[model samples]
Target chain A: MRMDRLRELREAKGLSREGLARVAGVSAKTIEAHEYGRTSDVSVSIAYRIAAALELPLDDLFSASLKAVTLKEAV
Target chain B: MRMDRLRELREAKGLSREGLARVAGVSAKTIEAHEYGRTSDVSVSIAYRIAAALELPLDDLFSASLKAVTLKEAV
Candidate 1:
């Protein structure tokens, strides 16, 4: 649910929150909620949209490598 | 929102739907709904959980290459 990298990436591109949200086809609130970790209900589809809009790989936006590893072990 | 790869990967791993759901920490219905495209509310987090459970990369599970490319151009 963390998106520090996303914030950095978006800012580096000189895009406002709403600017990216508009182009990504998601609500501004969705982008704000994700960047601020306001909720844990982030959808995979939206994340992919954001990543695509940013022209980066999806894995690059999350800081959850440890979590992915843990979940992998759980399976 | 397609997950044909997911169904195939799970079956190849010799896991029943419920079995994989148990291991992935998601409900069987979540797996079922996603597999059938019953809804488009697929969350990014759940998809990652499923992918982690399958021991496969997330990008491999989707058939939306064209969409991703489109979004990239939009931003």
Candidate 2:
């Protein structure tokens, strides 16, 4: 759920937080919080908006660091 | 951003929506909406919770259908 990539993608697209929020139909604060990792407990719908706005695959938004330990071992 | 797998995983773990929500620190309605695909724009934090509660990798929750077209060509 890391959003570093999302923010980077948004910036690369030349979109401001407010601009992206409008396109996603969410509040600026919501987008800001998401970018800062404040609202980790977000709905799937918001995730879609982010992916759409960033022009990324929904999977990309959820993609974890390959360097991290796998879930199979974590559990 | 499909949540079918989330629901399936929750069920496999024998957790009710309420139970999962409680564990994830969100309302049951949130879980319900997420499970039903009502919220496609969720935050990364919530995504992390869902993954942790389901004992899955964050990517597992976001993994898309490989059969679908990729985002690289979408834009």
Candidate 3:
């Protein structure tokens, strides 16, 4: 349910809450809810799409390890 | 939305569908729905809980690679 790393990563990428939501095909409120820990009910597809939008592996969303686990490497 | 890897991994662990659901803290129907692609709206916490039940990294749920990413290493 915690997503501090996601907020930091999104900020590091210079993406706005709205920007990430748009590209990830989620509502801006969805981004806000996850980032602020307002909800723990995120969908798997949305989480995966956000990771894909950030060009990082899905683990990147939940982990702080800088090691890049690309989708290719993951699959 | 595809989670064939989850079904394969579950079976490889020699766990019954109901067993995994109980261990993963999900409904048996949730396991069936996901394994059979009958639904695409899996919750993030449920997904993570299932991965924890399997003792596998979250990425393993969505990917075919056999590399084991442990929770310690993931953190």
The candidate maximizing TM-score is 1
lDDT of each: 0.74, 0.63, 0.69
Query: Across residues A1-75, which tens digit of lDDT does each residue of candidate 1 receive?
Result: 455477788998899999999878888988888778786656566777888778787777777774555466555
Candidate 2 chain A least-lDDT 10 residues: A66-75
Candidate 1 clashing pairs?
A: A43-B43, A43-B44, A44-B43, A44-B44
lDDT string, candidate 2, B3-74, tens digits: 547787888899999888877766788788867888654555666666777777655665466212222222
Q: What lDDT tens digits, residue by residue, belong to model 3 across residues A1-75?
A: 344478988998999998987777778888898788887455666777787678787767775332222211222
- If you score just chain A, what TM-score does every candidate get? 0.78, 0.73, 0.76
Query: What's the TM-score of every candidate structure?
Result: 0.79, 0.50, 0.73
Chain B TM for prediction 1: 0.77
Which stretches in model 2 have alpha-carbon errors above 4 Å?
A: A1-75, B66-74
TM-scores of chain B, in order = 0.77, 0.78, 0.77
List of clashing residue pairs for candidate 3:
none
Tens digit of lDDT per residue, candidate 3, span B1-75?
Answer: 545488899999999998998787778888888788887556666777777778887767875332222111222
lDDT of 2 by residue, A1-75 (tens): 445466777788899988887776667887777678785445555656667767665556544662133233323
CA displacement after TM-score superposition, residue B65 of candidate 2 (Å): 1.7
